[model samples]
Target: MIVNSDLTMGEGVIERHEVETFLTLAEELHFGRTAATLHVSTARVSQTIRKLERRVGVPLFNRTSRHVSLTTVGRQLHHELRPAWDDLRAAVQRAIETGRGLSGALHVAFVSPAAAQLLAGVTQVFHEHAPDCEVRIREAQADQILPRIRSGEIDLGLTTLPLDDPDLTHGPVLVREARMLAVPAGHPFARRASVLTADLTRVPLVRLPGHTDIPPRQAGAPPATTAPTAGTFQEALTLVGTGQGALPAGAHARRYYARPDIAYLPISDAPALEWALVWPADRHTARVRAFVEAADTLIHGHGTTRQPPQ
Candidate 1:
């Protein structure tokens, strides 16, 4: 069992500096190092630790002429206090952000033309909710979206859904576009009303760098060993337009990227492509949550479809 310190004593309450010194000394175990890290004198570090030991009624560290290490009680206290200290700091930071009324910059990005158009509507609504918060928007290739979000380069991303990565948090499915097959306009499949999953066996599929939801080579499909790779959705469509390969695309592409040489047909057996707001798993900040709420409002309240920009 652990003895509780009189942390709540009136007027005699333990100060923040005491807790900081205790945790730091517990981690560093060396008096000089702890003092250097806290920018205080070794004597001050010794005084703080002694005061804490007196308060706890036990020594927290075992000291020798050359070695310093945590006592058993010290280990227990560190185990309990470290996470609590982190949570306390985080709560204070959040309070600061909230106190400032969310009046800061929110960085957002979109992965596709359809996503960009939809983001335009979300941004308008977000502004209504957070007038002082500046929403900075950018367009990124599909592969760049997750990296930017993870590295804190961007706060949120509007991109394809069903990301299997554990580090990413996918928000609600804000937009759903029917799956379509983009074939060369003069190809036989273009004259057909729709294409089946089995039909993919006969056509080479273009590879979009980071789009994982597209169908893979079907059971008996020819090996895509020599398939072309596209950096952007438009590039993928262009590959299809040149008869290099067929592309599985969202229905919105037919409207936003209409081309004379490319024909889009419904995929009779494909699932709709889902789009949502994605952010780093550890970065669900107030601004991120607020932006997600705005997006939810746009999709549910307004029933915004993935249509070409008006």
Candidate 2:
């Protein structure tokens, strides 16, 4: 017969190690082997088992010099405690997820044109879905975003993909765009329906800094004249409109700028860019899920009207 005790009636210290030791001994059915597995001496294992039995006020094992077996009460306790321990583990996991600032500040990282256009929509949806969350956005290049994710500097990243890193997790948010040449109204290519990579060879290209990862380089064109400094798509568009040189920007760049002075012409045979949402592989939090869902809704609603880089 077993008597019920109320664990909540008084403060009692139930050390986790005692439970672990009990489970280990139960599995091994031998103190020496169990101690070996636990990296402790056999005497230490015996002491821990004795302590656990005494705490519960019940003998847990029937033992003699030749063999050891569980008492009837011990077998009953094992059945009850094992599942209780499993439930406790699950409860602890849930608590960690809930307590890790699920409703707190979410730091997001993004790039330019998408940052200006889609970010607001994503944030709006996220706020509507998770009203308790506070969001912040940071802008950085495609290459710089992942390192921050690994270091825990940012919660999520919106950028171009094919990261190829095992430590990062990526989800396709929206097909990104290709690098379209933004030219003034009077520029030669502006009169044509579309421009080819070879056409920019002679033009004064207001190219992004040399490190900018635009695709299908102008055939036989000179190397990029300067390093890329314009971090935002808007900055690049502004420079193209006012400067004498032509600049390469994403398809959405034209819409983002909404400038009549400039026109965006596609570059035939250029690589298409992919816009993706990236985060640390280990960061499976509620806030992250909420943010990704909101982003997906916004991009899916936009559809394939914006050509993503292939």
Candidate 3:
């Protein structure tokens, strides 16, 4: 129970359940929906709301045969209580986690072989730091990273940047590797010492599903056209090998995804590809922070290489 100085007597107190029920009902505006959301019966919801109204000394809602609307007082209360409730819940959760000493499950996902290897290192260090916490790691395709994070299926993602989404938070850059162009072994570009960004105009670039930052072609070159979209990095590399298109890949691919049919040529003028950890902006918990700290400790303190081993 919490005391509300804004209440009628400046001494009104309400149970935690009562606050939850009231807030849920206020948003739903329907007893049935509120009950379903709260996993309680409609009778229980009604009883709770009535008790809250009595305590507040006002009819907080207007109800007729077919409609439910919050009164002026109710609207003001909801406006003020929502943020306060969120803060209270967050505080309690932090308290519980601190008391328990970081001993629960944390789900993390990574895209690409390079990311997987880096995550492996980070996980080892994290386990050493928080041995009681169970770390679950999964591999996801490039396109599946954001959706899984948003849906709460994964607590963190290690993937390519720049992720401009405001809904997600990016961790410190863990790997920065030179950009390379992947082409068929017999392709002209494959035999060159290096390639240029303008060379992208000569052939269709194999497109990754969610990538929008295709290298810009040189001036006076024809505008780039739509290319085949690949769901995974392997598929993109396969497209490159089939002579359908070239792929812009990180230097790490040359080491991890070596293929006889494919050749990786460094892009002389292209900026390095950066890999980082990402998670939902609102879901940054102690476990997530701890894992990020582990990455910092590994890379900055232990002299972890910025690029995958050759």
How many clashes does each candidate structure show, in the order listed?
Answer: 0, 7, 0
For TM-score, the strongest prediction is: 3
What is the C-alpha lDDT profile of model 1 across 1-310, one tens digit per residue?
A: 1123335423467667788888998888889999999899999988988887887878999999899899999899889988987777777766668544567899999976778878888989999978999999998888888899889899889988788789999788887777888899999998999988768767888998887547544665565433598888888888989999888877877888899999989887877778889998877777888889988888887666443321
**Per-prediction TM-score to the true structure, in the order listed:** 0.67, 0.58, 0.68
Which of the predicted structures, 2 or 3, would earn the higher lDDT when compared with the native? 3
**Which tens-of-lDDT digit does each residue in 1-310 have in candidate 3?**
3333232324677777788888998999999999998889999998998988988889889998798999999999899988988887777766667444567888899877777888889999999878999989898877788999999999898887888789999888887888888889999887799987877777788889865335546668786545698888888888888888888877878899999999988888877777788999987787888999999888878676476654
Pick out the ten consecutive residues of candidate 3 with the lowest summed lDDT. Answer: 1-10
TM value for model 1: 0.67
lDDT value for model 3: 0.82
Per-model CA lDDT versus the true structure: 0.81, 0.71, 0.82
- Runs with alpha carbons beyond 4 Å of true place in candidate 1: 1-14, 17-95, 98-101, 216-226, 302-310
Which one is best on lDDT? 3
Better of 1 and 3 by lDDT: 3
